[model samples]
Target chain A: EAAVTQSPRNKVAVTGGKVTLSCNQTNNHNNMYWYRQDTGHGLRLIHYSYGAGSTEKGDIPDGYKASRPSQENFSLILELATPSQTSVYFCASGDVGGRAEQFFGPGTRLTVL
Target chain B: EQQVQQSPASLVLQEAENAELQCSFSIFTNQVQWFYQRPGGRLVSLLYNPSGTKQSGRLTSTTVIKERRSSLHISSSQITDSGTYLCAMGRNSNNRIFFGDGTQLVVKP
Candidate 1:
């Protein structure tokens, strides 16, 4: 089975703090994505990377940045966390094309106070 | 705008009964997938049926590319099957996939 693991399964940070969520996939998939899920909005794409050193903004990219330093790792960074950023975040990896299935990590729950 | 839409935002089923979920896309797409997420759990891919019909275990998924719609049929639903089912649509040109709000299912014994 494809494996995607995320660090700090749960986190709590104060407002204006910096938070970094990391994701690693052993599937070696070429595409990785970051998404945040909320009650009303469902899952909105925050950022995605085609490969190492490449990142693209998704539908909701404000107050968020992404880094893909290697094929196995992708990270979502919130330079200034806010109470509104408190949500469950998911990371997924997939094949080069959009036709393939995406494998999602366990998820990270962020709480900003 | 929500490009992907799922019907019956929520559902309640008795054990051993069957459940049917529907998904529709506003834009043309050849990439359609079904995902499942348990309460307070991660998302898992259930089916990747771009077109035609496909089955795995007690789950069946049918996609009609021309109609721009898909359906997931869960036979003999169990309590373990209770979860939020999400449908995602992708385009051939880009790697981005759009997601629906999801259909939350609850199974009662």
Candidate 2:
């Protein structure tokens, strides 16, 4: 089975602090995605990358940014964290097209105070 | 525009029972995928039925493209099945999948 691993499984940050969550996927899938999970809202897509050095906005990308420095890694950066950003973050990888199923990472739980 | 939507925001069931979750999409989605997530855990792909019907183990999924809707049926529900079932749909041009809020299922022994 393909494995997607995320670092900083748990993080606590003060408001206005900068935070970065990292994800690494061994599947070598061409598509990667970042999402945040909140109560009642389900999982909202924050950003996605088609490949290395490419990033695109998703439905809720206003408070977040993404970086894909390499094909195996993707990072989510919060310039200035806020309490509203306290949520679980997930990383996923998929095939070249959307038709394929995505493999997800263990996820990171972030708390902004 | 919020293209995809799911029904039964939550569900409670007993062991050995049956459960059905529904999902609807406003846009003309070419593919539909269903995922299951345990509390505080990552999502696992349960089914990826673009259209028609497919079955795996005790889980079955059916998608009606013309109707722009899909359904996931769980047979002999187990306590381990308690979690959230999320439905996502993807179109031809946009490989990004639009997700529904999901249906939280709680199974009691």
Candidate 3:
């Protein structure tokens, strides 16, 4: 089975604090993505990486940053957390080609106080 | 601009009943994918059909690429199938998937 894991499944932080959400995938897929889900809005893409050391901004990338240190690991960084950023974050891995499927991680619930 | 929109924001059905969910997109997308999410759970890929129709078990999905629309049909719906159904589309080479708000389904016993 294609497996994707995320760390700090739940967290609570103060405003202006730094928060880092980590994800690791064992599927050996070439693509990784970060998304946040909020009420009323659908899952919005924050950032994605094609390969190691390569990252690209998605539609809602304004408040987030992504790092792909290796093919199996991807991270989402929130340098200055805010109350508005509190939400459930999901990490997914996929094959980079057009016909490939993406597998999602269990997701992390973060709350900024 | 590219966008994916789902219809009937929510639905309630009795077990053994059939349910149909609709999705439409602005502009032509290169690919379409359907996902299911349980309350406080992860998003699971239910189907990926760029065009035409495909079936797996009790779920069937059809995507009309040229018409920029897709539909997911669930036959004999069960309580276990209750969840939010999401429709997403991929445009251009970026591989970014735009998603709809999802249709929340509740299946009564």
Q: Model 1, range B1-109, lDDT digits (tens) per residue?
A: 7899999899999999999999999988889999999976899999999999999999999999999999999999999998899999888776678899899999999
Model 3: pairs clashing at backbone N, Cα or C within 3 Å: none
Q: State the number of backbone clashes in model 2.
A: 0
Using TM-score as the measure, the top candidate is 1
Q: What tens digits encode model 3's per-residue C-alpha lDDT throughout B57-81? A: 9999999988999999999999999
In order, the candidates keep a fraction of the true contacts of 0.63, 0.56, 0.49
| Candidate 3 stretches greater than 4 Å from native | none
DockQ metric for all predictions: 0.70, 0.62, 0.60
lDDT of 3 by residue, A26-62 (tens): 9899889999999877688899999999999987898
lDDT at position A75, candidate 1: 98
Residue pairs with clashing backbones, model 1: none
**Positional deviation of residue B87's Cα in model 2 after best superposition, in angstroms:** 0.7
For candidate 3, give the lDDT. Answer: 0.90
The local lDDT score (0 to 100) that residue B65 gets in candidate 3 is 85
